[model samples]
Target: MDRKQHIAIFTTASLPWMTGTAVNPLFRAAYLAKNGERKITLVIPWLSLKDQKLVYPNNTTFGSPSEQESYIRQWLDQRIAFISGFTIRFYPGKFAVDKRSILPVGDISEIILDEEADIAVLEEPEHLTWFHHGKRWKTKFRLVIGIIHTNYLEYDYPRSIVCNVHGVNTKFLEIGKKRFEQQHGSNQAFTKGDYYIGKMIWSKGYGELLKLLHDHQKELVGLEVDLYGNGEDSDQVKEAASKLKLTVRVHPGRDHADPLFHDYKVFLNPSTTDVVCTTTAEALAMGKIVVCANHPSKRLLQAVPTTGTEKLSSKKFASVSLNLWKTIEDTSAYVHHLALGFEATRRVFGAIPGSLQPDEEQRKELGLTS
Candidate 1:
């Protein structure tokens, strides 16, 4: 095992962003703070009101952007235990998790050099380009790694160690296991139903899920569907549900640890662009059947194969197979698939190369710093 060491996390968004892509890095920082012996510093962007309203409108109830920003920073500070190394400053240029934008790497390199960090954790290749392949300035840190939290891997993979955040065990998963499971046990309440907990966006495939429900209205007689999270497609989802006359419950905010998981029979994950949906894994961990859309992530696909056209038959079940819905309707099949999927995900968690020891030769082999 590697000895305890200092880690500096440079993220593309502020701590308050609720999306898994934005919050995964925070989970990394928190895990380091709680479980490891290390000095951790988190540097994140402070978004403007327009950006805040665009991403998370329901969570930010403050009167102004300044208030929201202050509240969020204070909230995170309390959680991470703020100190001299912790930083929250606005990026000099625009920054988005999915979009291609260059960070102010010159300013960021200065911070790394000033802090004398042993490891610098970049969010993605867009971030690593600033330091690893620098022209004007280069980061002299012992190790620099990229945290690939999404599906954007078109650029040439970097030479240094690269990691996907969802595949790793995080503070969110640690606490969720202890908290949500205790509140909601293995005892199943509802005999048959469906639920989806994520942003209400087209990319999330909620609109398609609603369309499936609409198309299979007669097939879904006794089953109920619950939708959580808010986004641009919130109104559209509700409207579709209304048109279909499906008994769909819409929750305003995210709720992962509630009794909702135990009460539901199937967890719907119809996301189209998600690399690795942690919430889906969390639901599976809680012992619920998951029917998700097919994706290309080898880590996820290893467990849930892309083949198999068998669809379960039940009036309480609905699946749009033509639309690429990977339906898991059998109780035994669900358990087997969830176990396989979760096991694959857990294996990835064990593979994260974080804070290699000063004397480790593997770091040298990978051209990473000790």
Candidate 2:
């Protein structure tokens, strides 16, 4: 019998916080542990209610460590199959309000010593203070791999890999679609308006979107958009939208797999800061036309057939909106083709050794022989 490979994943975020960093790493862990040939240990930060409140003042779903662990287990049980070898370990942590992240306060090397993992995968290692602080002990692990999920260009690791695109949990999305069909009837077609789902902050392109709509009201008179998310600027966005000539409704954030996402004809993501906007990928996977911003960070999205990246100017935004609204194609026809490609990407985590290859420079930096 082949010996099992023990993999340890150190992540900064987890369930009860639905950011892409939290959701994607958890899915990777579940997918890697599904076949029972590997032992998966997911190490997450444990913040007290006070620290969590300081960092995420708007959040209300946080609980004690035990409660949070239970929530994660129940979530995986509902979405994934054969998660028997998966384990969740929590380490003491504190909040860095300026960075908007939690830093592990305890010794992370202790977890490595206890777990005896053959490989250690760091999700967004640049954001993890422990990774930088414990460089002397990194050699304890047989292999260390870093997966960059943000747009911090200066960050470099020996085996660091940056993904321009990420995968979604299509199984959960399919289940949500079936549930929606059962409740609302299969005849429900796509709605005429566009929609956006993500954090409602100004840096997320709310200012640009509102400005474009307000500046070119005559060109986009009939256009309607629904914005779903919550942030410090939620009320401000709502007040601004109310003054626009076009119809714009601001709603609270919903789950990424909300079946209502399938009802929209187009998805709008004007943010240029994201390196690999997971929601935009999810929209394309759902067969919806996406109008995203054209920036070097978002170049990967241009490869998709149903996505258009436009300059962030008011004129360009107005022109793209008018052009895309001219025709709404059948979204259902493209769902299978696009979704299967994303599903295939998720399976790559199961074969990490073969999938991730470091260049010669990176290998030399880590003092590894090819």
By lDDT, the best candidate is 2
The true-structure Cα RMSD of candidate 1 reads 17.3
Candidate 2 wrongly placed segments (more than 4 Å): 1-3, 54-63, 81-84, 130-132, 135-137, 153-161, 172-188, 299-370
User: What would the per-residue lDDT of candidate 1 be over residues 74-179, giving only the tens digit for each residue?
Assistant: 6555544334333333332233434332233223444454445677787653543422212212235777676665565432342333233454433335544554
Best by TM-score: 2
Give the alpha-carbon lDDT of every model: 0.55, 0.66
- What's the C-alpha lDDT at position 198 in model 1? 81
Q: For residues 228-303, could you state the per-residue lDDT of candidate 2 as single tens digits?
A: 9866678899999999979999998887666666678688988876677888877766666789877645645343
Models, CA RMSD each: 17.3, 17.1
lDDT of 1 at 8: 77
Clashing pairs in 2: none
